[model samples]
Target: MPKIIRDLEKKIFNTSMELFLENGYEGVDMKMIAKKCSIAVGTLYNYYPNKKELYIAILNESWNDTFKRFDKLKTLQLTPREKVEKAILMLYEDIEKRRGLGKELLNKNIKDLIEDARVSEFKKALIKNMEMSISCLEKKEAYKDDNSINIRLAEILLVSIPILIESHRHEKEENIRFLNEMLDGFIL
Candidate 1:
């Protein structure tokens, strides 16, 4: 895509996410998105045929943005344990920053949008990034063994940390501390 087009798509996606978070999926419409984006409704449709498509584009952009940040972190010469800790912390912080829209974007029903080719490709990229991160942990002997169980467990922990943070967000500081300690025991 051209630079200008990509920029416009990103602006539209951000605006759509904010509107969706504020008004919910059913409450927001294409016109609202266009108005918020300061773009013509026709221009928005040129990029996304429908609201579901726009929403999936937003999800893909979010995931792509995350991997870009992680890519930069991957360049650091940190140990595997530090990598895992930092990755978890960074991901948690990002999710916390967009907690409301993140919750909506993660709804299981959104998987239906994966039927789109671009969305499916983005999902595959996410899985690949996750597996690479898991492999890094395995290299550090973080897992007890190379068995499928250990690998699966590592993947589970990688995905679960964010959920744990979300669930504990409203709890006391002590509870958050205890959860992190428990996670360190399992992850390290």
Candidate 2:
């Protein structure tokens, strides 16, 4: 009979997140995670076959929280420009709040470890949200012949906003203004 270890899974999940944030994907190993959790490496593996699986799980959980505020956006009555601005701000603040984990996940070596489907899903969601905000524009007839502009713009903002935030080279307001100014030509 196996002995029951209360909260072992929870402990492993939390400990793994903390360690990954501090050391990054390459810096962490199963043995290191087990050491932090006060468990054997095999025990950690029993829950997560490899670091990648654990990382995906963590990303899934964390990203849900990151996008949580988006739900309320639907209920707000705002102009298209305001909606876009708010959406960018929301994303910026959320990523900034989790900068440590965000930076770790964005590391080149660490990104390769994550599956494409997971990364695509995250981008798809962001793009979808941005598209929704853009779609609210009354000037839909202007680009009726070419509808993909929304998707392309969404992708651009989705990629650029995070990079700008992570760089710490500009203030949040500056990035927002820059993005809005750039968007004016296409959107406004």
Residue-wise C-alpha lDDT for candidate 1, range 73-162, written one tens digit per residue: 788899875665566566666656665544543455755453567765764565565555555653325545655543454455445655
Lowest summed lDDT across 10 adjacent residues in model 2 is found at: 98-107
The lowest-lDDT stretch of 10 consecutive residues in candidate 1 is: 171-180
Please name the candidate that would achieve the greatest lDDT relative to the true structure. 2
Q: Evaluate model 2: give its lDDT.
A: 0.75
The prediction achieving the highest TM-score against the true structure is 2
The residue pairs found clashing in candidate 2 are none
- What is the lDDT of every predicted structure here? 0.64, 0.75
Model 2 segments beyond 4 Å from truth?
1-6, 100-116, 138-144
Number of backbone-clashing residue pairs for each candidate, in the order shown: 0, 0
Candidate 2 lDDT over residue span 1-188, tens digit each:
65567999999999998888888777888999999988888889899999878977887788786566676786789877788888878877776665556454345565565446777576578678888887776444566567788887777776787788868556888988887776776754
User: Given candidate 1, what's the lDDT at residue 123?
Assistant: 47
